[model samples]
Target: MRSPHWKRRLRVVAEFVLLYGALLGADWLVTGGSGFVTLSPNPYGLPILVMALAYGTEAGLVAAMLSTAVWLSHGEQVAPTGDYLERLLGLSLTPLMWFVMATAIGEVTNIRTRSLRRLRRDRQAAAGDAARLDRAYQDLVDANRALQVRLAIDTASPGRVIALAAAAISAPIDQRRTALRDLLTAATRTDDFTCYRVEPDQTARVWLRGTAAGARPVVLPKAFVHQLDRAADPLSVTTAEDRPLLADIGVAAAALRGADGTIMGCLVIHRTGFATMGSHSSAELAEIATWLPQVLDLGAQPVAPAASRAGRG
Candidate 1:
């Protein structure tokens, strides 16, 4: 296929040929003879000016060359009355005028075309940049609104878990255990939940062993720990598979994970009201477990030392 550059060149050449052919035909009708009529100003000026204004410097120069050829041909038909140099100088003036006018007007046309193209490009670029900025601003606004909603939910609840969690996060490393204990107690609304922290060797140590006055805390079974380890979220007594495993252990339970997604602890609620044990309550407990590592020291020593009376449940 022909490139655009070659196509444009061929079109320009064809236009010049057609223009000069029309001029030749007009000259023949006017003079009826070989030579041009001795008119004061030649008729070629109008056509050259039109070409220059329309197509810029290069096209104007091509037109000028074609006009000059026609002018010289007409001069050749004139009577040989003077010396060679004198005849040449007399014929040179009209051709010179055509070239000068074509160059000046054509140069101005080229400048205007370039300026308009540059302005169009700049405007398009500015529009694209503005659209990108608007999208970024909209994303930030959406994120801020989501954070506000989360804050409202946290503050509106009766538990005040957020306040206790904040206290745990800001408390001294030595005092973090007490803050975490308080946070969990308020979050669950019961003191009958057992908290166990997992050690590096995968041994579950009692962090806070909550026990009813006369009831002994049941020891966590291997099957229950295995289920909790595999669970992605918290498990509740309502779940069919978990219902059997959690029957004697608790109403709801969850595995506490660290930042790197490693299981760091386990929480088992040995007792809670029947009305407070459901999917929503389990989700709330799971959400609290999700942020435990961020606010509490998971690696600290156990809160309770004796596993005998509670049986490490």
Candidate 2:
């Protein structure tokens, strides 16, 4: 414990007086002025002992000194002997006794103070650690939410999936390239662009492409197509490079299936930013894919004579 300052000094003084008053009153009631000079228990010294133990050595010494002084002032009544040695012994011994008591009390106070300080420090450290863990937990939750959103967008529609596959196949032919470009653009919004496609053999493919006004379609190799093909649900590839590819190209593709569950062509579509493909988008895509075979069956018709001849040639 630190030494007591002036404020504590003043408090010690006040305590001394109150204790002295109580002792005086008790002495007066018990023995009137007759027992006042006796060396028995000085009730006034009790508060001093208590204060010394609570505040430490400095407070204890001050309380002991004050009690000694008060006892000495009442010396005449305490000692029957008018001898100087007797008076001296009484005065000196009383203070000595108070000092001993104070010292013992102060040691206990110091130990308690140290223990309390250690407990407080430990509690503070634990609190700080808890706060840090809470922040990390919140961050994880946010990341999970973002992932769910991305998955939705990636799997939203079979039309988009089919479109992406068709685009990859058509990109090499100049005349059909625009159709691929238009499909990719329509799949996602501006600023958040991604392109993905699948090969005719149902090998999933992905690429990065961007849209500009009246611009020709840009062709690039797809990344992580094998992983997508193996995944039962639509998945997002978030490697630093893959994220940019999805955002920039705005297209992705998957394999389309016929009513008999035979693999047909591929579907393709552009995606917006990371946030675009959320749970809702993925669900929509799944529903669309379920009905795709029927839609294609109804749309298919025989080619005209002129178109058939052109195709043969």
Against the reference, the lDDT scores of all candidates come to 0.71, 0.54
lDDT of 1 at 144: 97
Off by over 4 Å in 2: 1-14, 33-39, 79-87, 154-213, 217-313
Cα lDDT tens digits, model 1, 113-220, are 889779888988999999999999999999999977866674324447777877877889788767777777777767677787776756666667554412534346
Write candidate 2's Cα lDDT for 238-303 as tens digits: 333344444543344343444443333333344445565654655443443443333232114211
TM-scores, in order shown?
0.48, 0.49
Once all C-alphas are superposed, what RMSD does model 1 give against the true structure? 11.7
Model 2 clashing-pair count? 40
Task: List residue ranges in candidate 1 displaced over 4 A.
Answer: 1-3, 33-37, 77-80, 141-313
lDDT of 1: 0.71
